[model samples]
Target: MARRGKKKGRPVSGWLVFDKPVGMGSTEAVSKIKWLFKADKAGHAGTLDPLASGMLPIALGEATKTVPYVMDGAKIYRFTIAWGEARSTDDLEGHVTATSDRRPSEADIRALLPDYTGLIMQVPPQFSAVKIAGERAYDIAREGEIVDIPAREVEIGRLDLLDCPDENSAVFEIECGKGTYVRSLARDMGRDLGCHGHIAVLRRVEVDPFVADDLVTLEALEAAAAEARPQGEPGEDGRIVDTRPDKERFAALDALVVDTGAALDCLPEVAVSDDAAQRIRLGNPVIIRGRDAPVEASEAYATARGRLVAIGAVEAGMFKPKRVFTGR
Candidate 1:
């Protein structure tokens, strides 16, 4: 008699962090990784400019459902400012709009840097993706029409002067929350010192739970891809049978994909018994046993049919359904 068999399932879902390479858009990288892993879904948590590189988190499969949770996490970057010149895009990508003949001392820049260390209003660059009138501001700027963008509040938690390479150049590290623009920060720094400034180089060192040392280069990824191919697979165009599988393809995929549980780290967890799990699964909230004392009445109850169905944690123990994961 033939042996009984079980159905095979898809790969486990998880989050992957990539040290994003320069010159590639975040969406493009996500697409390539999706193909490599043959995953049904994927998304990046944050957007990095083409000229910037570093910590990009990619959510895969069920983890893609957690994109919004991590979208507002803090980011840290190390960038250099090219003093004495300002650019249209606020970086090296655009044409120079102004230049300064004088250079300020390190002490002058240091004193000025403190002014930008807290919350302030920053005007989004005209050549930015910020939408105005249902179109990208950059698109409108490219059409030769000047765009008047209003300033928005963003917090700069920390701004430390790392080094001054020369009188015309300085490097710094910044830790800021969502929507803070380092490019604009550099521009403002220059203006305060009585000199024009533009970002010469910028690298994100960290974003929330991710760090810089964990990034892999595109070259390394390509090499790994070359080594992971199956043996004896026919080579393209009758070339040597180089069947080494492309590990980088999967590596890139792995870097951006995250597990659903990992993605929900921000939320408080409440362990449910088998009965409670069943009730919650069936759209009914069961009263939870052994819950802590209630502090905030609003968060203490999960209602069903005008009655308290489940007792939730008062302050931080409230059972908020982030994303429901039903296995991989």
Candidate 2:
């Protein structure tokens, strides 16, 4: 028998702002994009609940290195609180555990927003990805186990009651830091208002450096790929294959993928010399002189000739390459 050949994929790198549809897990979206682009490596900055639909920033190849920075940035979510039933998971997917006939007035909801804003303690829903004893809390819950997720501090920069569509539900937008759960906010708000509620429609509008407007749907990507292909041509096996060359296909895909540097836009940038860039790539720290002497008192990205060189902390005029994008 002939030995099997290795999988063929290119070392594609960049970020794809995916407008993830409902009922699709983050992992599944990444896998589909990976196969679609034939990428050597891929990952997402944050995980969106399968029930939620919105911006899911996917990182391919070298872009994956910058995911942590994006993950730490603030997130914006616009969700609806259905104020009649409180579900076990605090979302539409879970079984209804309690019900109420009362619906809080618009004024009442506005008055309650202040309590959730700024720094507040939030207990994540039981049916969540939170870890407990080296296992997922949701997995434990599925096994008929009780999971008491602790109340952790999360920052909600802004929370506004956007619209109260009807007596059944009200829409709201929240801008929050990492670890804030929209479901918990809805559940807690309902309890405070003397009514039961759960997240009925949840959508993330923004994540760090990306906004909803930048999102590209999977269908759009598939269409672009189809457009890139020439009229069907026969292969050695006498089957029709994509006639577009690999370079053209990759170029078309690249047009949609955001450059890796865009992910570091929030970070202070330092443009280094070719010699300095070389030294940084070789695992050495170069001194930034004069105008570039003191970088911001935070992590910074160093680039050379408009290409990302290294991400590092610049302290006392020394530019150390913490993580270098060498091959790219």
Note the Cα lDDT for every prediction shown. 0.71, 0.88
Model 1 per-residue lDDT tens digits across residues 69-156: 6677788999999999989999999999999998989989888877898888998887888899899999999998899888999999
For each candidate in turn, the TM-score is 0.79, 0.94
Backbone clashes in model 2, listed as residue pairs: none
Residue 163, model 2: Cα distance from true site in angstroms: 0.7
- Per lDDT, the best of the predicted structures is 2
Model 2 lDDT on a 0 to 1 scale? 0.88
Model 1 CA deviation exceeding 4 Å by range: 1-12, 219-258, 278-282, 290-322
